[model samples]
Target: MERILLQLSYNGADFQGFQIQNEGRTVQYELERILKRMHKDFIRIHPSSRTDKGVHALMQYVHFDTTLSLPTNKWQHAFNSALPDDIYINEVTKINADFHSRYDCVGKAYRYKVYKAPHRDVLKRGIETHITETLDTRKMNEAAQYFIGTHDFTSFCSAKTEIENKERTMYKFEVIETDTGYEFFVIGSGFLYNMVRIMVHFLMDVGRGKRQGSEIPAIIAASDRTKAGKTAPAEGLYLEKIYLSPEELTQDIPKGTTITLKPTRRQLTQQS
Candidate 1:
């Protein structure tokens, strides 16, 4: 038997979520359906993280075990051939049987996109969240600093979340500018359900003059979810990357994943 790790990307627009449910399509179900056909048996896959419905994943990771022998290089092609266009197997690696995709994950990064336009760009409807008001990025950045350290994030988590331990280490949280919008990048040891989105919404409130950057500490101390503002739209959220190596989880983000802003294709075309 061998354990195989696969890196994938998916547009979560149609998925109920990464996890299997009583109804609706899911990333796991689609991939496993393809796997069962290939192995002639059910193959369970363990994903590193579960994203909300309508959220996207740019570099998600999953691992599975199988006794059926198959070339590591051939795995990607086999799966992609049958999977829907929204889901694609990017790379596959044969890992030791003991390796786990979820437990072994050391860190993760997420990007929440916002398009600050008066009218919604229908093309980006499912890709970016639209906002009509102007924002003070300077104040937003100042608010972001409050989230960049170890803290009990009870106030920022969803009421539906079952996890009791609300403390999570936020290694990095910053607002990056794009020509048409803003991308809120957050790297953390882990997050409670809806934590990142709630945090981002609070920062946005600061930007819009509804709240002050200085209020974050008190809000956090309260540990009340209502204090954090609304959760950001799932469609605008992307699970950017999962970091399993120790280097990426350090208090300071590594060189390769340096927290720098780069204009996206939409921004680039507008600039040109």
Candidate 2:
């Protein structure tokens, strides 16, 4: 058997989530179902990250082992032909048995889009978070800057998260103006569950003049969930990219202010 890695993107509006559940349709379930039909046996896949319901992905990675005769170059076409239109396989390659989609990931980039205007863009209804109020992107940018560098993100994560270690490094957090309004881009070594969504909500509050941009440091230090506002809705969030190597992580993220993301905790422990 050989290991295959597939890079994919999906419109998650109709998906229950990335992971499979007892009920409801899911991205994993669809991919696995197609694979089972092709291989005539189940082929388990490990994903780089799990996105919540109504979220989207521009670039996501998954790896699986198979004994099938599919060549590396043709894997993408084969998978794309079988996958639903909402889910597309962008690329595929063969990798070493030691390579892992999740554990080997060094960094990830996520973007949250907002469409602020008097009139709604019906075309982008489920694609962006729409708000009718004027927003101060400058203030949002100022607040986002405070998130740069390593910190305990207990206050920024969902209370439902079970991860024991709350510390993660934020390489860069930027607010860039787009045609639709603004997109909040975050590059990090890793993130706690709902961390980006939570931070975006706090930044939105700052943009609305409900809070000061200068308060972010104190809020982060508090380690209190109440300090951060409610999680931003998932429809605006997109998994922009996944970086498996330190070099790959450094080259991407346009207009990034920070230099490098710290290695994952597992990498640090292994080195020690």
Candidate 3:
């Protein structure tokens, strides 16, 4: 069997999350169903990350095995025909059988948009978190810089995580104001559950003067979830990109086959 990796994007507002569930519309379930229809057998897909419900993704990655004989470039067209309006395959390629989307990723970048205006736009309401509190963008930007470089992020993760190591590297972190809102971009080797959201929460609190900028180091040192701010809502979060090694990206393969994505909302509705 030939392994291929598919790169895609989706508007996650209507779905429960990225993972397959017994009863909910998910990205995995939709993709899996489509793949089974094509293969007439079970096809397993591995993704770089499982974004939370209401979260979106611009460059999500997944790998699956297929025996189709078409060229890699053509898989994009074939897959898009089966994808729903909310999701689309942007790119497709064959890769080494051992190349895994999750483990092979060097890093990931996520962006959280915050609408800081007095009133929210109808279109913007679902994509961004509306914050009326007057924020010092400069101060927030300055505080976010502290998050760069390697550090123990135990304090910033949600208490739900079972991972033992809270240590991760932050390659980049910045906050910039836009025409109607503020944007927070974070790039890291990896992230803990709710780590980015929690960090955004803390920074928002700092921007509003609810927390001191100088207190960040203390929060990191405390290694306690209670010391951090609330996990930001999932609507504002998006899996922006995944950085793959050159070897993983340049592999050759046969095509006519592609990975599938499951929509999250359908299963949830069925469950209810």
Best by lDDT: 2
**Model 2: CA > 4 A from native:** 253-272
TM-score, prediction 2: 0.92
**Clash tally, candidates in order:** 0, 0, 21
lDDT of 1 by residue, 1-272 (tens): 87888999999888898998999999999988988998889999999999888889999999899887888767888898889999988888887666677877777899999999879999997888899987888889888988877789998999888988788777778898889988899898788898888888888888889999888899889989888889988888999988766654654584444332122111101100
Top of the candidates by TM-score: 2
Model 3 lDDT tens row, 194-223:
899999989998889898778888889999
Query: What lDDT does model 3 reach?
Result: 0.80
> Model 1, 242: alpha-carbon shift in Å?
0.5
What TM-score quantifies how close candidate 1 is to the native fold? 0.91
Ten contiguous residues minimizing lDDT sum, candidate 3 = 263-272
Candidate 3 residue 98 Cα shift, in angstroms, is 2.0
> How does residue 117 of candidate 3 score in lDDT?
65
Q: Which runs in model 3 stand beyond 4 Å of their true positions?
A: 246-272
lDDT value, residue 53 of candidate 1: 85
- Between candidates 2 and 3, the TM-score winner: 2
